[model samples]
Target: MSGGFFRGTSADQDTRFSNKQAKLLKTQKFAPELEHLVDMTKVKMDVMRPWIANRVTELIGLEDEVLINFIYGLLDGKDVNGKEVQISLTGFMEKNTGKFMKELWTLLLSAQKNSSGVPQQFLDAKEEETRKKKEESDRIADEIRRTRDKESRELEQEKLKKMLASAIIWVHVLYLKTAVGRRCK
Candidate 1:
């Protein structure tokens, strides 16, 4: 019978021990904070899920599953300390929630390129189109008003001229009749 002993590498053992120690220390230091953060994040995510889903899917034209996967990828990143940190989409809302949300919203807006949160070029183009349409409409309305005013002024002038001519003719006839009657008397 041969004596046999199985031995693993010391480096592997040290790495495993270090990882476990690091995890333990992290939990000890931030367990309460982590718990609270997770709870709050969960609540927020639940409340905003429907609206976010609708905006991402209908407005942004992205699939709900794709958005979920993208967010999950974002959350599954390592911290600066090189610890294996996992932030679930439903939990762990960090202090940068607003920033991350804004970034995601911007990404969605970029897909449409419309005015409400679009790129500068797209916004400018949309504004230009609206301005041109409004200017055209205003021009048409002003032209119509000017035409109508000119027609009204012409009609008034013609009425005045006819009245003046009739008055002068009546005065001349009355003067002639008076002169003829005086001469005859």
Candidate 2:
């Protein structure tokens, strides 16, 4: 049983085989080719599609078609497939039109609340109206807090000055009383 390919004390042969296997595994990893399909920019999105879809379903309870439509709109109507569809964005959105429009509008509005272009000058004014209202609210809150803080500090300083003046006045009164008593004596 000891005269086969692994006979006798062949430490050099054993080490050589182990190195060869290590090198083979290092050069030829057994990972799926899909992981490195494109750039790393969308690797997380590709990997987490299932998780995102599950969460979207849980939050919205949308049907499969509705979910697909919503996702389609979110991707700006671009096909998730490897091929790039040469259709316009408006056309793409039109293709997925259904009851999902309301939900898509809500989603897009929320996303573009902070930043994004409006459809027209009138729409820009409307968006600016909301932005200005929010900014005014924040400014008013900051002003109120700053005023309150200033008043509180001024009141504290006034109290401290009064206490110090009262102490000095008490000392002067005590000195006067002492001087009058000593004079009478």
Q: Which candidate has the highest lDDT of all?
A: 1
Candidate 2: list runs displaced more than 4 Å: 1-128
Q: Write the per-residue lDDT of candidate 2 for residues 1-185, one digit (tens) a residue.
A: 65576556566666655665446434632323212212222233332344335544554565455654445444543223111211222233343332233333333333333233222333556789999999999999999999999999999999999999999999999999999999999
Tell me the deviation in Å of residue 113 in model 2. 18
Residues 31-149, candidate 1: write the lDDT tens digits.
22222111122122342344455544554445657655555444332321111222232233344333345444343334233334334444567799999999999999999999999
Point out the worst 10-residue segment of candidate 2 by lDDT: 81-90
- Residue 7: error of model 1 in Å? 29
Model 1 poorest 10 in a row by lDDT: 35-44
TM-score of each: 0.37, 0.31
Clashing pairs in model 1? Answer: none
